[model samples]
Target: MTIFHKLVSRFLISPEKKNEIGFCTDLDDILRDDGKVTLKIDGNKITLDLSNLHERRYAACLSTSLRYPQYDIDNLLMAKFVRKGDRILDGGANIGLTALHFLHFGASFVECVEALPWLAERIREIDDIRISVTEAALSKRSDGFVDIAISKTHNQGSTYDSSVIAKFSHIFGDDIKFLTTPTITIDSLTSGPFDIWKLDVEGAEIDVVNGALQSLKDCPPRVIFTEFWDERVHKFASVVSASHPVAYRAGITKDNYQLELLDMKTFEKNSEVFFPISPTYVFLREDCKEI
Candidate 1:
């Protein structure tokens, strides 16, 4: 670190010693206002900017030049389903990273559905012509208010913070606040024979899919990618079967999902760990054979 950078770090830490212990101060100037950071992914460069008041969880991962834990997995899934002029549905698009990837790769249009207003605001900052950003939660009901949970780490979006459950009386705790926003069922909100659908709504993956049953049945997108965790895997699997039984007819077993590992260059290789305990799952429609 340069002397000037070190001095700045020292100054920021001196004020709140306890809170600033592990915080990075070298980039504080660049982060002066919460915003986007331009990054290079698999040799392709893109910019990510978000609301200044909200902290971006993926910022650290992107800024440190660390590969996104699920980037490889997502890429593999995208490779199978994405084609030129294909439409993609990106649920829980936090900061538009995944949407950016699809748009950059040649998807005709991407509809990003984000529940958090702040995060959606950040996505709107992108002047890209190929992507459409929507600020609404996908729910079973077409119109109603739902609890938009929030976590300490990523104040903009809701997250499951099991560790802090005991300390805080509520799941969201005082640090987070809930706002009633417009909600829509996936089918009602979008009219699509969309080529690909990606869902990553924390633990609410099933609920979001449940609301999109009609669309899934009608279009049966070539591929579906969602973040499934150990705790909710069974529920997610059940929802997949019930909602799109024909599309997932091979059965809900682990093998049917076909998880492939990815490298920095976006190359695919087989691995045991397909989903990071807190990772993303990419599912290919049974009818669409992989090339």
Candidate 2:
């Protein structure tokens, strides 16, 4: 590290104390020698790993507002759908930030599924009794393992689909690494009842949905929050239509965090411009009230 960075890291006010001051020091500037930063959020001490440039960048963005990109949507879900002691399933839970938030929002139990072993270890470090950590990729296969293509430079965008890796090669760069991780379908991992599920499995959303079909039928969740890319929306819509009858595109910008009920026909009609505006989606059963 540069001398300036070292000085900043040593002298800057600690992130855990940021709330008292109404703002946070940029995490990249205040990264510690241990490669972690502890921030107090909503009365809980949350520590994040910034050992890599990718996470450092992500932390820098989150430090500004003390929240992640999906903060608003999660708040909306809690306010509208979640009840006290609701069970949560956090798919692609990177380091358990959202899981912590779910606990803060009154979740009785949370199951976190993360593909990367290192990231899963970070989540396990929290050691919260209400949270359980699983270190495996959620894929179509219930038992075998799956290959993940992880970017050496930026690990957050790693996925089992090589096509997704190639599509975003410029962002991930040429420094890619491959590894095989154990797989568990959502249907198998979640045997009991669950209320809310937040899924963000990169480009493998369809795989997760496919694996959870039986569970979706037997034990339907109150809400399902996920992201949809234009390329994969059709198949995802087709597959999820059986269980979730209501769909809405969640607007993520600062000024517009509202949920717009989507008309599939209209969305497809304007797919050229509409699909790219917001990838966030909320799916609910017919009996559930729209949020």
Best by TM-score: 2
Compared with the true structure, what per-residue lDDT tens digits does model 2 show for residues 1-291?
544245444444566774332212344455543467666555556665566654554444444433333344566556666779999989999878778878877888989999899889878877788889988998887778988887665547778876778777775667666789988888898534689888888888889888888889888888888876655866776787777878766543433334344566665554444223436777888888555
Per-residue CA lDDT of model 1 for 39-137, tens digit only, reads: 654454555443433232244444443233334446545665578888988888887778877876779888888888887876776656677888888
User: Which parts of model 2 have CA positions greater than 4 angstroms off?
Assistant: 1-35, 42-44, 50-71, 253-278
- Check candidate 1 and list the clashing pairs: 34-52, 36-48, 36-49
Q: How does each model score on TM-score? A: 0.66, 0.77
Give candidate 1 misplaced runs (Cα > 4 Å): 1-36, 39-66, 155-175, 242-277, 289-291
RMSD vs true structure, all candidates: 9.4, 5.8
